[model samples]
Target: MGKLGDMANKAKEMAKGHPEQADKGVEGAERMVDERTGDKYDAQTDKAADAARRSYGSNSTTDR
Candidate 1:
């Protein structure tokens, strides 16, 4: 597999057991993007974060 595919597989494995950390990772990445872009893409970022949350968030969380 390609590097990206391998990385994705690793991330999937990591998230399988530690969903909260996966959620935090998504939030951190969103924050970094927002910071770099000076929040100009807040709308898009928010939407993406929501999708990520649904995918990675714990079942107990509202977003999930």
Candidate 2:
């Protein structure tokens, strides 16, 4: 597999039983993006974060 595919495989393995961490990571990314854009796209970022959490099998909700 290519490097991108390998990295995706590793992330899937890591998120297997650690979805909360994955959700946290997604939330952090969302927050960074929000800050960078001055919170102008809060809804869009939140939706994107939720989508990412779903992809990682994360049921944990972000408090941010």
Candidate with best lDDT:
2
Candidate 2 residues lying further than 4 Å off, grouped into runs, are none
How many residue pairs of model 2 clash at the backbone?
A: 0
lDDT of 2 at 34: 96
What would the per-residue lDDT of candidate 2 be over residues 1-64, giving only the tens digit for each residue?
A: 9999999989878986698777778878999999999999999999988887777687777775
Q: Write the per-residue lDDT of candidate 1 for residues 1-64, one digit (tens) a residue.
A: 9999999778777786798788777788888998999999978887887776666545533332
Give me the candidate number with maximum TM-score. Answer: 2
* TM-scores of the candidates in the order shown: 0.69, 0.78
The whole-model lDDT of each prediction reads: 0.76, 0.84
